[model samples]
Target: MSQPTDSSAWPPPAPRTPRHARRRKLRRAALTLVAAMAPWLAGSWGASRSSTCTPRTAHADPSFWEQVTQEPEEAARLERYQAEMQRGHQQASLVLGEGRQRDVEPLPPLQRRQLTQEARRAFQRAARIRPTVAEPHYYLAVFTFFALHSCAQCQFDPAIATEIVEELEAFEALSPLDPRLTSLLGDRAILYTRLSGHATPAKTREYLERAIADYRAIIARSAGLRQRWELTYGNLAEALMMIGDLEEAIATYRLAQRHASTASILLGLAVAMDRDERGVEARTLIRELGPDAVASWEEDVLRGDTFYVPQGEVHYYRALIAETRGDINGAIAAYRQFEQSNAHPQFAPRAAANRAALTRAVTRAVR
Candidate 1:
């Protein structure tokens, strides 16, 4: 699925000692980062397009879709509308270009808002013209979901949220048996489960349950999508973990591993193991990643022009695990190494701060 460009792994900052104050800071940072990440519905828009894909904007005309409607054949009109939708999705990535970094400035609020509105309108018009087409509805749902986090200070609006779900439901109804429906459901599951933390307990449970069902559904329909199966399986485990079903989460990750073993899946397995109190397994998994394996994953992701790498957080978690086991020196080393090597500014600062705090605490205790 095509979508707006945004940040990756917008997790809360790693907590520091003095648990109460750190928890408050974590909550605030989490909310802010959620907006920062933009919560776009999918990965790189370019990656979503097949080699035969052509952009509507190759001619640089805003009236392209309007012109397309004049085509006599409904199939031709639908093709043009779909191309317009792709342009809209690509324009979003073009507007935001790469992602916001500490050194790079993002688009101005006014320009961003206008461009985002344009994209939304493009997606909207596509759905309006081809009311029966599932693709348009899927893009509309993506745009709506992304819009919820497109701006800073954006809060969860129940109305807008409901609209997203409705659009997804409509898409599912149109393409009940389409394999692509699995992708749309996975997007819905991810969006809802991620936001559930800030929502009510009942709401949280509802979303987690929905996500679990969708993920399972994808697994059950594994036709020719081994890759999607692994991805969805990991997500199911994450949803389970969010709801404190750690045992199931662990089992699911293991199940995913049996099908395909990638760094992203390995990270999920490691995190689940650590959270499930299997520190030894988590540590071994991290060690198995090694430097070469980590580097290769990074290179592969960069080659694909995707910025988000699940392996990036490996060393950060490694430091936390070391610290939890009371190896302050080991934790300090790991944190510093992570801060120096990682590109994500958000996590680097957290790692640096933790490293400094640990260093100070160790020094004070020695005295």
Candidate 2:
């Protein structure tokens, strides 16, 4: 059967729409938890393959007419399926306190689990009824992700992460032309990146590579949407840097700068350039941002008020800047601060090495 093209019939509206207001509440809840766990977990970007049916070809499909000729039984079945999906969605939203002004009073553990399971079962049944439709899968993914995130006892598990990714992929496959596809991709990419933080070195690289791909795809899909491009490019650059692709990371940060030279982008660009041996350019960028701006950015990150920048990365960059300026004590101090923050497991050892090297140089000079 041909998939329905009607927005109302499948995929639903974007999160900003009144019909999807619950999404905003879910986002707030998820982000609140994310802020406590990791500062870099928020923000959105994405891209996907175009559907085979072009606008011109859509009108010529024979099955398009068949949709209008559905028998009463089939029509009734579809209505029931939609109702089931909506019921699940609404149940999940209420459990999460979708539009309530006050925060949801914390539910007892047993009651919470029961309500969450009930909502999950409803969405699962809806998916079984209409496997080709994307809406059920989309909600399932969202509900699962946020539910786990909001659960105080739930640790970040790779198995659950994989399941969420599969659900998102199903939605993407079924709704390639949907406007929300990019946002979904972006969320999946962020999930991968977060998973990488707790993975082994080999697995870390694999996750970062996947994240980089998704961010690039988002950049491509965003096109003239300058803000989206800017944010995605910044994210892509950070992923590249994580995987030690300094040259590409530098280039990506520059591309992001063209769209909007936000402080986070500039800081990323400076760090990438400094690492790539473009110290002069990197220092110049820092000067443009100034010490006050860097301090402000760092404060926001430490306070968990910022997105798209990892915590403590600013201290690492500051150490580099201090070292370049021949301030051994200041450089060592900054490196120690970076270490104390315990951020970026991949870079912590490097910060220690640099600090040790500076210590050795200072001792030799004293001799």
Candidate 3:
């Protein structure tokens, strides 16, 4: 789906381990690297697009639908929407429960009020054609999870969660168990992981485990599907890292690296290396990812930077190297560089601090 550009994945320096700053940088670096690699992990959209295949961006957001209403060129989106609407059947969704049993219901209402509406309408439309199809159900579950994470005042909606789970349970009863379930389950696990919020890392790990199972099953079923299943390797790596399983995360990343090597994968490797406390090895990736990976946009996301690649992550990463060489200015400069490219709204404070600290340092030096 075409999104509002990419989010920066720069690592941050947390307060807990400021003294073990090297470890802090690398640990955070691993996560940043994994997040940065997601776009590539999803695989390029080039081959994915076919004559019938419409863009995923417009469909990614409801705005695309509204755009078609205004601008005629968005006819493709309208056509796709209409077609999907026409297929209002359960089977039309293709599968109700693709990967996991994460059919949780009732989401935080205020958080994703708009998205909930979209999901309900889309799911209802699809259910009209193939009430049996899992696509709509899976998507609805995904939407609910996303809504669950919104900043709006909300808590776990156990009932809605139960409803979605029952839907998936019914799906399991009617649908034959096979590799097809892997894809559906994988999606469900990802959704659950996203919605789990501050839940124990154990829960997140469990969700990822389900996702990983689906990915691995897909790989095992047919050799023809290896490329697609392999893509989940990065996702698995990210999940493992998030749970603080650095050892398993490294292994998972290496496995993915063996399948394909690109800037994204290399970035993953760099992150893994940072996690493993192998700063020297991590550098190899940073060099390859280049100084600026984000596409240019007008926004000064981090500082006055024109793009965002989650590069503030890079600052926390390179901080190790700067510290290792006893170069305070260089370390601070790297942090500032990351701050300039920060895009995520969540990390604004730290980014600002880095920018301000560096600015004051520069000013004092001139004095």
Candidate 4:
């Protein structure tokens, strides 16, 4: 899978919908015990990919809901329908809470699949009962996408993809002005981007471009939510980087930096600047971050804290900054620190190569 840059900088993520709130709560609850877990463990033990996912409810109970609930006294039926929808939301939240336990105690494949299926069933019921509301559809899309990767044995379901688009289209029609709609759009963008992981290059570019467009739209209308704006820009920069648009990525990260103060954004900007050969600029930002600040943030991450830049990535960026400034020893040391302290499988090889090349250079210089 193509890895996207880490985007976990904003703490206390913006308020979420009921289902998402529950999911976030799971992470927060796990944070207290995160220090006890392996430093490399992700915040969530994402769904297991070994098994196939089966929707808990094969199909909505057309008769039980449509006839018994809706066909009863019309006035009472509406009230009952609303109640059912609320119940559905609650059900989904309950399943999500269980899934979140993966942060504390890793879930087995069967349990993960069951939780996702149950959540989907609840959300599906809500969507059926309240066709106009966006929450059910939003959660459905999220859960489906998440399960798609987790259930590696499952075949891609075109129907689910179609459902997500149709639901999002309906949501936009229902609430054009609701601010939460922006988040939904961003979610859709991410969905497409994730799909592009196993897609053709053209498709990958197309999805990433779509994600960028959604992010840009949010930025255009972002009025009050500084946190959302920061996140959107960071996401946009990440998409840009995926497509090798280094210059734009650098520019977008700079924009994100102004909106939020976090090591992740700074590191993002530093990485982009380095890629674009703006090493001096990268060094400046890294220096501003300083060693102490990076250490504190890493400590938080090690303790299973949520909403901070990742633990070991800082060292990688610092090494790059040192290399740009011709500080061979500093660069080598930072690279070593990263290797010793963090198990970032993706960056480890590159770090080793950089270190080896620098060591060779130093040996020649001495000769």
lDDT score of residue 107 within candidate 1: 74
How many residue pairs collide in each prediction?
0, 1, 38, 0
- Would you estimate the TM-scores of all the predictions? 0.47, 0.65, 0.42, 0.51
In candidate 1, what are the lDDT values of residues 1-367, reduced to their tens digit?
0112343422121122242443454465556545534423222344357666543323224454443333335544555576667666765654544254566677787877787778767877777777887876676666666555533446556567666877888888898886657655666665565546445667768877887887777667766754556666766776776566878888988887887776656766776676565757876886776666556655655553222222344466657657755789999988876677652334466567668878999999999
lDDT of 3 by residue, 283-358 (tens): 6565555444422111233332221123344455455345334466786777666556552233345545644655
Q: What lDDT does model 4 reach? A: 0.60
Worst-scoring 10-residue span by lDDT in model 2: 1-10
Query: Model 3 Cα displacement at 183 (Å)?
Result: 3.4
Ranking by lDDT: 2, 1, 4, 3
Candidate 4, 99-145: lDDT as tens digits: 34455654576776676677567667656766776656655655565
Off by over 4 Å in 1: 1-139, 142-163, 173-180, 292-367
Q: Give the CA lDDT, 0 to 100, for residue 114 in model 3.
A: 51
Ranking by TM-score: 2, 4, 1, 3
How many angstroms is residue 330 displaced in model 4 relative to the true structure, after the best TM-score fit?
Answer: 8.9
* Span of ten consecutive residues with least summed lDDT in model 3: 1-10
lDDT of every predicted structure (CA atoms): 0.62, 0.69, 0.48, 0.60
